[model samples]
Target: MDVTTIIGLFVGILSLVVGFLIEGGTLGSLLQETAAIIVFGGTIGAVIISFPLKTLKKVPFIIKYAFTASSSHSMTTVENMVELSNVSRRQGLLALETQQDMYEDDPFLSEGIRMIVDGVEGETIKDILNREIELYERRMLSIGKVFETAGGFAPTMGIIGTVMGLVHVLGSLDNPSALGPAIAVAFIATLYGVASANVIYLPIFNKIKARLDDDLMIKELQAEGLISIQYGENSTLLRNKLMAFIDDEVKSESEQVEDVNVNA
Candidate 1:
């Protein structure tokens, strides 16, 4: 779980609720089916119209990622790359075939190994990997745009809901008691719109952006690992290079262990 995502969401909601309570507002004041229909329904409708079906299917996964850390194995990936580099240097690139099973589950590792096995040139491999990364980035951005659009539209829809309620109240202005309830309802839409946009849609957009950045970093690590392996760098040297991507504490521990082993 991502602490930042959880804390951010919790704090946003708590602040809103506390502010409303301080203003003597009840929870029921913000509940309006008409407002919900306008904001949520319209937003969904617009999103469906804007994005492809394939992209829409990724919404659930995107939501999950909002609260979860990325699945990239930073330190483990570096270790694997170092191992592959060693193997390639000792027994030629073809030797990687024997260890394919070890990295089979990792698409980035598998792809690099497969390309080497197929005798593809380094430039060709880099081009192919870059293309794949670009495609993935585009798809993620498309998904992120959906949330961004929702954030943008929800407030507008709220205003529409408010105007609609005001029109109803204006028609019955002679009934002062009815007018009060109608005015309250009208304002509810605006509240809901602001709350949803800030707490839900905008946060989702930010989370998606963060996830995309992590993914880009993971891909960069993979690319560097593959290139190091192809160049047949010494395993220890390659490992040190990869360790640069890890946190300082972890890198220190691993370096100390390596130093001890070398001395032994």
Candidate 2:
């Protein structure tokens, strides 16, 4: 589980409640079941209409993954790519075929190595890998757009709910004593819509987009490593190239390990 995401959501909710209480509001004031149903139900319906059914089907997965850690293996990827370069330098491109299991878990890495072992030209390999990256990005953006659409519709839905409530309240304005409570109830729908959109839908949309960035960076690194190996670049040059994608602290640690291994 992603601790930061969980904590962030909890803090957002708590802060809202605390601020409401500080302003002389009661928790009961925010608990309008009819208003909630109107806001959320309408928002969901509008989102379903905005996107294709197949795309909406991915909403649960998108929400789950937004709070989940990415599966990139960045440091391990650098190590693996550097190792492949060393192996190719010592042997030849055909030698990569015997070590297929090293990249078996990642299709992008696996396919790149497969193409290299099959003697595909460097330019062709780069083209195919770049295309794969582009398609992957488009797919992720489509998913993120679902949440984006939801965020856009929520506040509007809130206003719609409030208007409906006011219609009913005005129709029954014969009792002046009930007017204050009725007006308060009428605005609850708007509060539900605005709050859920800002705190939930918008945040989830941004989170998913950020995850896509990390994923793209990892894939780009794999593509670079594969093309460099095809060129039969030496391990030292390959390591430096991949290190550009890593953190400075991690680079220092990797260099220290390499020095220790060489000295021993």
Candidate 2 lDDT (Cα, whole model)?
Answer: 0.88
The global C-alpha lDDT for each of the candidates, from Candidate 1 onward, is 0.82, 0.88
Model 2, position 189: C-alpha lDDT score:
87
Judging by lDDT against the true structure, name the best candidate: 2
lDDT of each residue in 135-213, candidate 1, tens digit only: 8889788878888988888888788888988998899878997877789988788877878898989988988897888
Lowest-sum lDDT 10-residue window in model 1: 71-80
TM-score of 2: 0.91
lDDT score of residue 215 within candidate 1: 79
Q: Per-candidate TM vs. native?
A: 0.87, 0.91
Model 2 regions more than 4 Å off: 247-264
lDDT of 1 at 260: 100
Worst 10 residues of 2 by lDDT: 71-80
